[model samples]
Target: MIQRFLAPHRTVAAGMLGRLARRAAVCALAFGIAGAHAQETSSIVIKGKDGWLFPGWGSLTQVDVRGIDNTTRLIGQARDLLAARGIKLEVLLLPDKTLFYEDRLPDGQTLSPEVKARYGLILCKLGQAGISTFDDAAVLRQLKASGQEVFYRTDQHWTQASADATAEAMARMIGRDVAKLDGRPGTGMTLGPLFNERRYGDLAELFLTADEKKQVGREVYSVRRQAESSNLVDDAPAPVHVTGHSMVQPYFGFPQKLSSLIGRPVSVNWNPGNVGPWIVLLEYVESPAFRQQRPQVLVWQMFEPTFAQGPDASGLWDNASIMSANAWLDRLKTALSH
Candidate 1:
């Protein structure tokens, strides 16, 4: 699907370079101070090359092999439990933006060998564990190489185009595994025309000061609108459910795209903050919604950076969301059993 847009390579390349130049100018003016001093201003935001900003939480060189193994084990157990209840678990592990844009890292900042290999390692581990997952990194990389910005320059979330592309890929995977989905005809979503808007990304909004924001300026974002007249019919339960963070929110058009492509209603539950995937999953499965009508396919989306961080990672996840790995599994078991 993404390959179809490659025919306009010249046009897209010109636009891409133009945007890069604008962002580079803005970033240069915004961070006039020395690199070390600029980093001191915001502990949460990492100043990168060409006016790009990254979240500090996702360290470029942090790789915990043990953590990854533990996470894989937990996910495998969760898959078994969900399988028993006839729910097909599809794990969507989103690689960090840095993986794709390492060239844009701040001066002297480079990805360590471990960081470079972490994603592939996790994918291998997941496969070895017999867990069903997809290589989203490969999909995004392909889009990026084709001149499509899969991620925002100053935000942690994915762009609308990337979301649509991913949804298309995920739809293919789901279709192959589930064979069919149960939903009413014409229950899918309709995507409206694409529109462009200039806005400060989350990193800039949260970390940059008023003067800094003005200097950095807002970048143009391509957004897809949901057709105003389109609405999902609630006559039957949604065959698919997506539980994740801000990336999967309606604002980014991920769920809607998935619904439209799958030709079925896709129920979604997402929290903006880093609530952690474990808590997000438990929240959905434990809710009355799950008891009333459980989805046939559960798309559990998680970030690669935090994939290794267990449910009890103190500072990473909120206090309420934190718990022992065993405790989380227990709750999941109870929820599925009920």
Candidate 2:
């Protein structure tokens, strides 16, 4: 006992190491908890009634949002530049719901009805200037009245179901009659479990968030991988060419899924962000290579928000290599006539 007591430094050093080790463990645990917490919550705050989700802060009709000046003149110049280089430009704008429903917005919010009208005016001005833009505002308003959900619950993107509707709108825009393609596959045994867990976007992160994860909603993906040769749609497909932003990218595969929808195999281009729809549209219209192949249908994938303001420095018109609005429009007209 006396010898054990004689080793005085042993007790002090051992106690110090124990406390340090415990503190390190606590710190690691705290980090893990914080990370999980973030995953459960929405990074962007969106006030939605019931459970429906939608594109927030990125649509065309936001109140007090920034827009470019001399929109008409700029688009004309941009179009001419693109057409000379052989491209086609079609513009569409996706309006924001919040701007329209300012009265219903959370208290202390400044968005108002006048702001909505102002944004609408901007859209009208652009359309009158010859952009061949889709009548999205009317359609969206109608959809809203009918209680149809167009946007996702957790992400800024529209849902696959909404995409299907958009695809139908696109087909109609090009003057083709097409049946809506079914994103789901035939047969239960053919598809995998991945299809059952349809959560694809920010919702996935929500599923892992600290506060929301436990109660985070679970919704399976509307589209799933089918067997090697399963039927996804009911009819025969026609060759289609789609140009737009990332909103249209799923067109590459989704079309192939529908029995009547097929990709052109002509290798169209795509860009993301809030814009870039017209760039690829212009590319397909101007390139002789694209024209020679002659895709039977031209589907323009667009989001309305980018269309309201026209080109900024980062817009497709600014990039000399990818997008030109004028020559591309001429080529588009030619392609349409031919």
- Best candidate (score: lDDT): 1
Q: Which stretches of candidate 1 lie over 4 Å from their true place?
A: 1-42, 232-235
Cα lDDT tens digits, model 2, 1-338, are 01110000111146643553344334334323111110112124444443333344342223222232234445544444444543444444555545445444444554433334444544544454444456666665666677865554554455455555544454455433333322232211222222434454453363345555334364544544434544344232224445555554442232322222222121234555433544455555556545455444344444443443333324323464333344444555665444
Instruction: Tally clashing residue pairs in candidate 2.
Output: 27
Candidate 1, residue 149: lDDT:
95
- The reply for model 2, stretches above 4 Å from the true place, is 1-72, 78-88, 97-107, 176-196, 203-209, 213-216, 224-240, 251-268, 274-302, 308-338
Supply candidate 2's per-residue lDDT for 63: 26
Clashes of each: 0, 27
TM-score versus the correct structure, for each prediction: 0.85, 0.52
